[model samples]
Target: MKIAYFDNNATTRIDDLVLEAMLPYLKEQYGNASSVQHKLGRQGSHAVEHARIQVAELIHANPKEITFTSGSTEAINTVLRGISKSYRTIGNRILTCGTEHKAVLTTCEQLTKEGMAIDLLKVNGLGEIDLQALEDAIGPETVLVCLMAANNETGVIHPLQEIAEICQRKGVLFFCDATQWIGKLPLNVEETPIDILCLSAHKMHGPKGIGALYIRRKSKPIQIPALISGGKQEHGLRGGTYPVHQIVGLGEAAHQAQQKFEIATLRDYFEAELLKAVEESSIPTKGANRLPNTSNVLIKHVKTAELMTKLPQVAFSSGSACVSGDRDPSHVLKAMGYSAEDAYCSMRFSFSKYTDREEVDSAIQQLKEAVAAIRAHSPIWEMYKDGLI
Candidate 1:
């Protein structure tokens, strides 16, 4: 069976061009970037700096502000931990929402144990926080505001410009997780007033285990301490030997995504056809501005796990790939006012530039068949049809 992949939001297949760019660094160019005394080492160092410039140009950021990390997880930890400590004397409070990624949510939760006040702003049914509520929440004790450019599961986009303005006017630092937003959408850090941001390469068709954190240095300088302590690397912010090959892959991927083709046309067609074929199916966040390549479909009464088990030819997700092993309902949907049953019945389908209409049609047919098969055996589905629930 030919498999159809709709899980690009979880992680994308590395582009061939990115892999080709990284080949030499993994083989002949294996010299350490920290070793500048030798010729090969200096060459490797130059390659790393070149890759940094490539990644920086993609987001219109200063190359000096970029700091490489293992992935967005590490970058998030570094920012949250470092800033919370650095600004502890200025303020004891951090503002964020419950619908954020686990990395941000978990780190903020942990900071509460260290005497930091963590306030979670509520999201509406559309997974959007009230701008007025956000502005009102910023007290003198608030040090930082954490938000994401786009949600990982639903792909609903937050108002970055407005949020940045709010944080700027309040004199609090704004940290955005652009992990799922950067490659899919255009971002100009110089135009926006964000204090810090994070992005992972794997989400944009690059190699895994390499990402970057953007720190504001010129306008409103932020003094954040190092998360990892050791040798001088990443401007003494993150220490250790650099992964030159992976960094090269990330840079190449960024270059490709900069010129990626339009994807919303395919995504819209997929959603329209699927909704027409599948009974009572609807998109939960249709009214919100979402990523062009993502659609979270709610197939009432058909469980996502059962749908996946029945149809193995298509790859999709119930929620974030990081917590796929957990059987609990999606926290994101739950935050959007969905019940556990509704959350269980929702499936996330994400696309990429490589995705074609034929693959989407095939996946839609498989989904229609699988959903019908599962709902046929469900007593709850029968009740829903009879209006007895």
Candidate 2:
């Protein structure tokens, strides 16, 4: 069976160009980036620095501002841990929204155990943060405001600019997890006043296990002690031997993404095709201003897991890939005011520039068949049809 992949949000296939760019580093150029005397080490360091330039160019940031990491989760954890440790004397209070990924929520929970206060900002029914509530949440004791540029589950883009402005007015450092938004959407860090931003390489057709964090340079240079204590690396913020090949892959991927990011037309075609196939039922698209490549739809009367099982040829996800096994409904949908049932019935379909119109059509047909088959067996659908339980 030919498999149709619509789960780019979870992870993307590595681009051929990116792989090609990384071949030398993985094969002949293998050396420790920390080694200064050897030629091999210089080659590795050169590759890392070159990759840094690519990542920086993608976000319109200075290469000096980027710090390499394992992935978005680690980058986020680093920022959270670093900020909390550095600002604990002034304030131990952290603010985040209810719709954040497990990484952010779990990290905040860990901090709470260590005697820090955390405030979860509530969102409206559309999965948007309450701006007034965010404003009210920030106080002198608030040190950091954590938010995501786009939600992983719903594809809903947050009002980051407004939130950033709010944090700036309150003098609180703002951190944004731009993991889902970086490659799919256009971003300018300088224009958008953000203190810390996180990104992952795999989501943008780069190698897995490589990511970057953007730290705003301040007049006094806000220093957060190293997360991993070892040889000095990543400007002494993260101390470990760098992955040269993976960094090269990330850089190549970022360069490619910058060159070929035409998500709007492709996304529109997919959405139109899906709506055409399922005109009677509602397709739960994110509210205006979402990532162009994402589509979150609720197939009523069909369980998401059941649908997935029936449609084995297509690759999709019920929610964020990171929260796959949890029985609880998606916190993102819940924050959007979706009921438990609505959240459970929802499926996330994400596309990439590599996705074609034929693939979109194939996915729609498979989804329609899967929904029909599953709902036919569902007692809930039968009862609704006969008006009897």
Candidate 3:
């Protein structure tokens, strides 16, 4: 049986066009991008530069400002660690939201242990940060503000432009982890005052193990020391032999993502139908603006772990894939005022442009049946029906 994939925010299936663009590099054009002494190396270097341009074009950034990394995790580490080290003389504090990805939150925790003051801003129940709280948090001791464009679990979008402006006015650098937002939505660095940004290719239908970090070089260049230093690669920031095929795939994915179709209709339909089918189901982040392809639903008294086991043909996530192995409830939901039980019961279904209506219907039917089956054996559900605690 063909599985119904709805965990796109974790990763997407590599597009055929992206694969086609990468195969040549994997087979015949396997020259090292750094070994530019010979014709083959020159060819590899040229291809790498071309891919840089393609990736930059997707975000309306200058090609020179894009630095390739292993993925968004490395990119995030590069920005957070590099900025913290390079700007220590200027400030010692870093501000970030409570709902940011583990890539950001984990790095910040390390920095805090290393004597850097780290402040986590609280988010409302709707998964939005208060702009006034953010602005007030920036002081002379603050060097950087780390925020994500979209929450990986709930898909709630942050006010990026406004946040960037606040950081700019306060003379603090803003670094946005756009891993979940880059290819799905249009972002222009020229219009927004974001100082640094990172995205992974696998989240955008490209091959895994490739990503890019964008640093502003236009007005006043955002300067930071190298995170992984050895040889002169990625502007001496991240040094390693470039994966030409993966870079090529990332470029093609960015190119194709420019024309990706709007998928909100299918997602909305899925949520509406599921809510109608499952009793007492609720959308946790319904009030906030979310990604067009993401729906995070909460079913009271129905544990997602139990429901997931009943529907083996379906693919979804209880939270971000990075920490899926951990039994703890979703940190994103907990940060948004959800109880641990509610967070554990929530399921995230992220769609893609290729997701069809039939798949949504099938997933909904399977989920409804699975949820009913789980609730039937749930003593909590029995208590809920009997109007008892």
TM-score of each: 0.98, 0.96, 0.98
Residues 29-96 of candidate 3: C-alpha lDDT, one tens digit per residue? 88998999987788789999999999999999999989998899998888888888888999899999
Clash pairs, candidate 2, are none
Better of 1 and 2 by TM-score: 1
Specify the highest-lDDT model's number: 1
Deviation from native of the Cα of residue 235 in model 3, angstroms: 2.3
Clashes of 3: 0
lDDT of 1 by residue, 1-389 (tens): 88999999999999999999999998998999999999879878998999899999999988998999999999999989988898899999999998999999999999999989999999999898899999999999999999999999999999999999999998889999999999999999889988899999999999999999999886556888999978989879999998999999988998998996899999999989998999989999988899999999999888898889998899999999987778999999999999999999888999998899999999999988988888888899899899999
Model 1 stretches astray by more than 4 angstroms: none
Clashes of each: 0, 0, 0
lDDT, candidates in the order shown: 0.92, 0.86, 0.91
* lDDT for model 3: 0.91
The superposed Cα distance between candidate 1 and the true structure at residue 333, in angstroms, equals 0.6
Query: 87, model 2: CA deviation in Å?
Result: 0.7
| Cα RMSD of predicted structure 3 | 1.0
